[model samples]
Target: MKLSAIAAPHLFIPPEWDREINHIVIDSRDVKQGDLFIARVGRDNHGERFIETAIQAGASAVVALGEPGFRCGILGVPIFSTPDLLDHLSDWLHRAYAGVSQLDLTAVTGTNGKSSVTQYIAQLLTQMKIECGLLGTLGNGIWPNLAETRNTTADLSVVLRHLNDMAEQSIKYAALEVSSHGIDQRRIDGIHFKVAVLTNLTRDHLDYHGSMEAYFEAKRRLFVGGNIGAALINIDDGYGRRLAADKDITVPVFTYGHSDKAEVRYHNVELNARGMTATLTTPWGEADIVLPLIGEFNLANATAAIAVLAIQGFPFESLVAAASTLQSVAGRMEVYVKDNGPLAIVDFAHTPDALDNVLNALKPWNKAISLVFGCGGERDRTKRPIMAVIAQAHAAQVWLTDDNPRGENSDQIFSDVLAADGSDNFYCIHDRRKAIESALEKTDKDGIVVITGKGHEAYQEISGTRHAYSDAGVLIAQGYRKAGEDYVA
Candidate 1:
């Protein structure tokens, strides 16, 4: 597309320069021939510093937040200045694709389980034969046709572009994971969500939000933003309950939980090595649902999914039948049990609440439990000690290991975690592989071993480098092959 064509309504560019621009890119590293580079102000570094690099790499033109001198430095590319480059980029893209609308968006936000819930909703929609798109931690794009992305939540400009792309592709629905940071930064400004689901809030992103109240408020923005047609929330969570009580929500609110008072309630809950089954009673009707995923938390997750689907007009019988087919979300309460050995679970329970929930759910299966987990470096340190207390309180044996420790001393992170519990039953291993091996070696045959923190992640980042690592891969290497294989080690 010509520069003038794409920038017509959003920019007052000279008509002659329309043919000069061909492609648009935000990152200077990705600049190509005929590309228009957008110089954004980043958290740590100014993107303008790379203007010379981008132009030299064959950028045709440059759009910057502020003035980029008289020209585009050495490459002499045309420079366009805007006070708010991000907003301008979004506006330009939206104008370029005027036919696309942002109406049918659905955002899910919380500390944990957001990705799983988002994925579940996407899967459910796909099973219903709806043309849907998903944008979350796993990546973003049309369901079953995802494109890998580094950011869990895309920037405002990229989000608008993706929404436009989805609309162009005839996508009827979009499930989005609204990160607290993204919410606070207005990354989801223009999009209007039809349904907003709040899973739960916990201490996970203190490094960004700084306080629990601030974090909760960030999540509240999605529902209170007045764009959503309905809100699906887990009333069992204090934050979710508080959000449900909000007087400003003009849309319908559907609450789900184990509590009888919830609009969508579940009772006669049964969880086992096979999975979970519960009697669900909603305002619409009552039905039994058997979920393949384990954990009471997962029951709540399933309930939330059902509640959202029901609010969206899906029949109760369909939900009950479909609930059993819901597969295990990768790394979230994933169970592997063998005929002759211990049961093993791998999860992404890095937060205190998540750890407590996972450990509590596994308590019924085995009295002897071993947990292997670690706190990430440069993250919310407040949860480190809290997680220690929760793990030590729940697991019979605890193996503390390095999780990520990005740029921070591994020993320091472990020390803080150890100090949280003040328990001698826990052993520290700086090497993650050794920790898993040690846990496997020490646990009894009937014991259950849980490897937590990094669930679906294929790599462990440390000191600015990501090394190939996966808990499941490690377990598989040590004789734990299939879902029911015994690990004799």
Candidate 2:
């Protein structure tokens, strides 16, 4: 593509540099000849410092916020500066792709359940024989073939590149998990959403967002700002209810929950070892949906997904049937049990509400529940004490271990958790692997051990170092490979 074709008209492009370009990059290491390098502001340092490196790596041109520092010296490339760089980049991307808006896109955002809801939307669509691509923590691809990604929502350049790939593959639908940071940073500014979903909001990321209101406003940008065709919100959540009440949105809004006013509501739900079965009532039609998922929270996720599909014009009965066949998301309520071994569950429940929901959902096992959990360093400190309280209330045994204590003292993090609970059931285990072993050893053969904080995560961080580690991998290595009877599903 010509350089001028992708450049925003308002931004100045050197006449001599208006040549063909192959790609755009944010990281200097990924730059190549014919590539346009972008230096967006970051948390610690401005990307401007990497200009020389991008040049060395063969970046043809440079676009960044503000003027370059004197230390960067003179650049040989066409250097451009703009105070409104992000908005301009968004505009440029929209014009460059052109057909991105034509793809069926669903944007999901909330404190939790974003990954589950996004993946569910993709899976349900694929079951309907629709080619769908997913972008989130689990990875990006068409269903089972998804490749892993570092962030729930990738940066603008990566997202656009992936969207282009999906379009090339003829993917008709795409579901993405939109994070508060992503929205706040304008990572998703360019893309238009066909359906916007608000799973729920709770006390989380206050360390970064400062307050609940600011965090909510970040999420609210998706439903109102983007060219959204429709909105699906979980009214069971206070924040979701508030979002549904907003009449400023010109697009169609659909509410889902157990509330009397919900457009799609479920009643008389039966939850057991196998999963949950609920009688769903929707405006299009009604059906009893069977979800092979473990928690009441998952039932809520399914209801939210149903709303997305229903808005897409699928029959409620077929959505319900196809939903039953959907698989559980990795590391979210994943269960493993072996003959004559303890039952082990691996879940990515790091927040207060998420931890509470996962533990409460395991109530029907009728076995001693031993929980191994920890709080991440440099995160929401308020949730630490609250999680300690929840662990005490639900688990018969609690083991506190290091969960990515990056740049923070492991002992101090453990101390904060210890101060939260006065109970005698808690034990401090600094080693995560040892913590899992202790949880299993302290329980009876029929005992249930649940590992929280890090699920499907392959490493542990301590004092700015990441060591390879996994809760499920350690549990299975400890002779818990056989499927236990408790995992009926």
Candidate 3:
């Protein structure tokens, strides 16, 4: 495509100038010969400051929201300014890929379970023989061909580009995890969504949203605007219930939960050492589902997926079969076994509500429960105390430890967590690895150890650096194996 064509509505250039442009890049480090560098302003710093870096890397043109701090004219590169460069870039990218009309897009957002549910839906879609694309913490790409991304949700240009790329590869559908920050910043403005799923809302990202209400409002954007055909929500969540109550919703709404009032309700829900089984009562009919994934919370997640797929015109029997064949999402309720002793579950339950749900789901197992978790630094601190209380209330033993205390004192974070649980039943360990080891070492043959927070993540952020860390990796390294497998170490 020509440079003039790419920047059409925003800027005018001749088709001959197309040869002067190579590719579009937001990051200065990735800028190459004849590339158009997009200087987007971020929370920490402005991309304009890196203009020289991009120029030095062979960028022939620059697009920014405002004037570049440096003399771009001297570099002999064209500079373009738009009202909102990111939005313009997104629009431009969307136009570039106008051939992707048959794509079905499903976006799932909430304080937690976004990644897991997105993965679940993607897996089921793939099993149904539909070409699918997945975008979330595990990275964005066609199913089984994921690439690592810096953000849980990609930036506007990257997102559209990925979609276009998938379309070119003949992918029929895509499952995306929409974060509150992504929605609030309008990063998803230009894309059309076939179905939008709201897992639940809780106290999280207060540092960004400033309040719980604002956080919910940010998540509400996914369902309110654009081409969203159906809204799949969790009626058990307060914010979700309110969203369902809103009469202004143009799209059909589908509610899922244990509540009878929900459009897709569950009954006779059972969670045990093996897994979970629930009798799903939907608008179509009633059916029993046995999920390989543990926890009743996961049952809710599964039901949300089922409801969304059903509303999208998938057959109910196919949805149920696809769901029942679904396996556990990595890191969310992941079970690990040892040669002897208790069952260990590593989950991404960082929020208070998530913690409560996971613990409650494991209640009927008749085993001593040991919960190991912590709060992330530079995030919503309001939930730290609540999670501590929940863990203490539900678990036989609560282990409070570090969870990516980025740029915050580990001691201060630990202190705040301990403040929530005043009882002697809790133990504080500043080191996360040590905390997990301690939890496993202390567990008996009839115990259930749950390692929570930072699920599917491969690193731990501390201060300004990200260190290689994985809870599951550490557990496996410490002589832990599948339930019946022998640990060589």
Q: What TM-score would every model get versus the actual structure?
A: 0.92, 0.94, 0.93
TM-score of predicted model 2? 0.94
Tens digit of per-residue lDDT, candidate 1, span 296-358 = 888887777767777777887877777777776778877665556666789988899998998
The 10-residue segment of model 3 with minimum total lDDT is 480-489
Candidates sorted on TM-score, descending: 2, 3, 1
**Candidate-wise lDDT, in order:** 0.79, 0.83, 0.80
Q: Candidate 1 regions off by >4 Å?
A: 8-10, 20-24, 32-34, 56-58, 67-76, 84-87, 97-103, 337-340, 484-489
Candidate 2: segments with Cα more than 4 A from true spot = 67-76, 482-489
Instruction: List candidate 3 segments past 4 Å from native.
Output: 14-22, 32-34, 67-75, 82-87, 483-489
State in Å the error of residue 435, model 2: 0.6
Report how far off residue 109 is in candidate 1 (Å). Answer: 0.4
